[model samples]
Target: MAEKSGKAFDFRLFKRLISYTQPYRFTFYFVAFAAIMLSIFGVLRPYLLQQVIDKTIIPKDGGLLVYFISLMVGVLFLEVISQFLFIYFANWLGQQVILDLRIKLFRHMLGFKKQYYDKSAVGRLVTRAVSDIETIASIFSQGLFMIISDLLKMLVILGYMFYQSWQLTLLVLVILPLIVYATRVFQKKMKAAFEEVRTQVSNLNSFVQERITGMKIVQLFTREETEYTNFKEINEKHKKGWIKTVWYNSIFFPIAEMSSSVTIGLIVWFGGLKAAQGDVITLGVVVAFIELSQMLFRPLRQIADKFNTLQMGMVAANRVFAVLDTEAIIENKGAINLEKVRGDIDFDDVRFSYLEGEEVLKGISLSVKAGETVAIVGATGAGKSTIINLLSRFYEIDSGTISIDKTDIKTVSLPSLRSHIAVVLQDVFLFADTILNNITLNNPEITEEQVQAAAKEIGIHDFIMSLPEGYHYNVKERGVMLSSGQRQLISFLRAYVTNPGILVLDEATSSIDSHSEQLIQDATDKITKGRTSIVIAHRLATIKNADKIIVMDQGTIVEQGNHNELLKISDGYYRNLYEVQFAEV
Candidate 1:
């Protein structure tokens, strides 16, 4: 029942799906056998009725009648047992396959670089992981085995009917072509509708996710009505997609029913005429053919319904498999290891751009000695933040060598390289969990007491203690409950507790309260005293105590020195920056 061409099934997709069933091969094969048995049993009920009416009931054979009824009851029990086996194992297989597929998909996504995420929607990926895979489960539970079983049942029923009486079989068969034609058209049309429905659902999910995350901005700008209108458009498209499927169903199913009703009437009329004329057709045969015709036609309709489920499942498989097929991740080709870093860093002729030929970091070279504090001061888009991104290997550089100690960063494992460095950014993201878990991030080596000690050392212990639940406080989604200043303190504490060899503070105090700024400055002084620290700052006052100050302009380093040394030059970029900021005072 997997999606097919206009003429035949898509065996390639069928093979691919079957390949996944290899792990549970024994169970899959057993379920398939049970489905065959179920099909065989499906035709038995009509066959037994035909034999009973002809051989036992009409002949008045009481002994044979009791034996046949007992046998019929036994067949019913066998059919029931086969159905249970088919349903239970098929569903079990689907659930197991989805569990494995979801885990693989989530793990594959974790390895993808920042560029992949920049161009993709979170909700789209989530749909593939959750909803799309659920659709695939229908392949087993509704589509694959059930379609085969129904087809087999129809074949057996037709064989019995033709053997009993060909004239009546031919009468029923005349309307079969119409049902088949309608079904083919219905399958194709519904597939297109299902595709549109999936696309609209993904769009709706992505739209709602972004809007909910940024609801504060929408409310601040009084744009609720504008967003609502946009949401209505997306929702309407989704509704129209489903309506098209319903429209197709309304047209196709009634035609099928009419064809079935016509087939039954033809059998009754033709068999009646033939019986009156000669002994060619009997009452038992006429009666059995009627029941058999329902068996044949009802399955055709049921199969069309199941084919819709199969089509949707194939669409979902294509979407999920598309994500798995993407090769957009950084490969680990390096074996360099680091137990403890010496913190010597270098960027030699580093050139990088998020997009090709749109250079954000232009041939910039700089170095930080062991235990040195280098503060970078620049305007927005001056590549100050880009430097941090490259150092962390969040994005691959266009052309450059970023080295730590004597080893190039590209020659070292990502975990080893990043484990030694800690970064605190302006925008802090906190999980909707306890404060202690946020700080530790579930790192086993960093104990609760160690985090508490680090907080106290930075003079934030008293502030954290003032919270309603202290270290156990739940920060809510994205730390919405805490002020920006409080979140910044938590970030600082998180970085400090890591005891990293190198520390980075990027615009860390740019958007915080005065009290928080003072506390952060005091904390920054204590943390950067002996570590290799790189600070990207907008405020020139923050870098005055830095051992080295690198001034950037338009992706290039224009000046480099201590605060006093750079200020001595009258027209230097750092001096000019200092003048503009302090000129207000």
Candidate 2:
């Protein structure tokens, strides 16, 4: 699912992620300064400890001991303060970076053409916009900032160790190569493991999201046992991926700890022998070296773990940048900004295909004059919906042009073009919000009074008032609390409130009961009056009074006439289709 990229660390991605901190550069610099202060204060503690042991305890000088102890305590207090500032500011900086990143990524996704979403999983995108971004924050909080602090602390400890006695420092270096090699190997393996873990997490999220959304289908088919088994398989894979990283940590940490112990043992053995020989090495010096050795090895060990953190953040960054790098966005290059549209539409030799070499809309042509209602009747897969999609520029046409009021729609700004159109589909979606908010979509320009007026004009004001809270009623997620027909009515109100120049009803009455259909039909009549309307007719009876009924076969129009004229052709496709529907009724 997730592929490992070049190197355990990606400098390009790291640099790009760092650029987000430009807005908070002062905080970033402050954290770096804190890291330096922490290192300097850390070195001061052991030196003070050596002074207390040699200059006070050895000579029984209590006053000198008090002075050194106070200094040591002071350094410890400052070190704590530095540590606090480093943690608080680093986390603050990280939260700010991911906040901007998530917003930019979401805005980018919003501009992507429908074609891009046609092949994308909602769950995978959710992971990118939410959880994956959370992981990238660790790059600042635990990855880069901590690594720099630990490395600086280690270097400072190393310099002081050499200053005390270069020979012992050389001895400490003996076990270092082994630790470094182990850390290097651990980093490589952990990077791959973390990438796989992220991939599995995305897969698990996608599977769960889809299954939950379609739980009705799973139960309807009595497939709970089968689906549970599938879930278990996916979950088992996720667990195994994480356990592999755990296995690496299990092996690596203990080895580094044992290495640290061995170095400590070597220090005590060498320093003890030198003391017995009356060399410069003394009791205070040996004890201080012991403290310094632990200080050095601890960070070296932690650096390995923090490097994995860095690696994981890099992996997540790569995934997020991949989404940001996509060229699937609909470019708003059109200079035209039409404030109002007369709604005269034309499709001149329009050809389109959802997939290459498999055209869904053949080179077809159609027109609808301003304030006219035209009905397109076709069987499923006959490209009736494709025509609507193209008209709205949901998918680009491969050849030819679609025009609104004789102006090419491609030359009109997207917001200006789409603002003039409203669509009501068979499967209507409503947000988990109050009915008024859902209808108005939280547009401040359209107030509660306007929504009430639109509802009354569409003949659904009484229906809404009959509800427990009227327009204030909350329609839960996707309007599940409401019936299919009720949701469709809400969608109608949503569309009508916008006062669009063009109205589209794409099989809007296909699955509703007779009573709801009557309500929708009444609403439809009111909304479409004097508006250029396109109706994709599922029931042939619904379009009997349509101004123009264009019958489609495959992807091309087979008949174009009013009901009486089409019925006059006894052997025509429309006549036969109408007769079949009449028989079914």
Summarize candidate 2's per-residue lDDT along 1-585 as a digit string, tens digits.
223475867677788889999999999999999989888888888898888887999899999888888888888889899999999999999999999999999999999989999999999999999999999989899989888998999999999999999998999999999999999899989999999999999999999999999999999999999999999999999999999999999999999999999999998999989988989987788889889989888888888888988888888888988899888877787889878877799999988899998988888888899998899998899999999988888888999999999999889889888889999998898999999999999989999999998888777899899988999999899999889989988998888999999999999999888988998888888878899999998798888878888888788888898889999997999899989999998
The residue pairs found clashing in candidate 2 are none
- Quote the RMSD, in angstroms, for model 1: 2.3
Model 2 TM-score, all chains together: 0.98
**Per-model TM-score versus the true fold:** 0.96, 0.98
lDDT of 1 by residue, 106-133 (tens): 9999988888999999989989999999
Best by TM-score: 2
RMSD list, candidates in order:
2.3, 1.4
